[model samples]
Target: MEKVREFIVIPQKKPETVRDLLGWHRKLLFDCLKQELKKRLIESSITELNRLIGKMVPSFEGEVLDSAAKLKLQSINELLQEAREELLVTKKVIKSFYKSNETIIAAIVKSHMGEETLTRLRDQHEDTHPNLLHEPGWMLEYQVAKEQWDKGKAAFLTFGTFMDPAKADVIVISNPLDEKIEFNLDWREIEESRE
Candidate 1:
């Protein structure tokens, strides 16, 4: 059994204002919710995989439990394949959740900073802004923004939900605000192309 871990990040000093308190509370709550969802999804995948593997074991040599065991072994492989596909699908769904939240955050920040300010910030950061590019969710936004800029489309900064290191999803820049975008990267393709 895997031990599930929960993380909480509270402000160094207690929140002084009502808005600060609310913002902190919301961040903590959403962090927990996101972790729980990820845990559940992972556990579900493991359980299904284990169940299928167990069913497969009975079909091996020795005193095979009849043709039923063989059928079950075949079924196990199919089930495992299905589980893999489902896991990929689930990952995409999770990514989409973060992307949608990013959109909302982008809108809020844009409203406050104004489009020109956002563009200036992006330009300042595009090549050399160390902090923005290295931050947790910012890289994704930066990549999306760069892609959109290359295509002459509007770019946006948004927040992304992530688990490792567990910090509030912060600003990320995305491009092509009107089009549905996916950040599926194929490392193998990139490597092959380079060669």
Candidate 2:
């Protein structure tokens, strides 16, 4: 009864209820897992593309293109097929990622403005993103953001100038499609730099 006489105990504010803390932790875990998966997928895709590219015909300044060039055609065809398959898989991965991104954006929109506002935000995003239309891979990088469509359409939209314009070949906005994704002969300049 010594301290019970007139002692007033102030209850400490429960530090972020257990549920809130757990929710935050879970979100962090999800983000980490998603990023790791995405990294692995992108790496795999790049490896596949590189492998295909390695098997293709070497570039030259003025190589004679014989209509009857059958020596490397078979190997090139096989490599092309493999590349196509890998691109298809990559397209699926990209679509999944896009859906995830959209979901996250939608969540943010709903949190701040509600569902009705989300549609407007999405429209605004599409409008503002203004892709450079129908440019080849090489020029697309310098002038626009390009995305690979499932139907083998590579679409581009102008975003802005590159930080170091000379170093910027193209900023690939999306993964390649499943079909034989080929850049125009004019766009070969960008590809030559890698060689």
Global lDDT of each model? 0.47, 0.38
Q: List model 2 lDDT by residue over 18-118, tens digit each.
A: 23222332243244345445556656765765665565546522687465544456555666566555555544443443343333334333544566765
Give candidate 1 regions above 4 Å deviation: 1-39, 47-65, 115-195
Poorest 10 consecutive residues by lDDT, candidate 1: 161-170
lDDT string for model 1 (83-182, tens) is: 6665555445544444444334434445555767545554544333122223455556556656754665443333332211133233333333344332
> Which candidate leads the pack in lDDT?
1
For candidate 1, give the lDDT of residue 8.
Answer: 25
TM per candidate: 0.39, 0.33
What TM-score number comes out for model 2?
0.33
Mind sharing the TM-score for model 1?
Answer: 0.39
| Residue pairs clashing, model 1 | 156-174, 157-172, 158-172
Q: Any runs in candidate 2 off by more than 4 Å, and if so which?
A: 1-72, 127-195
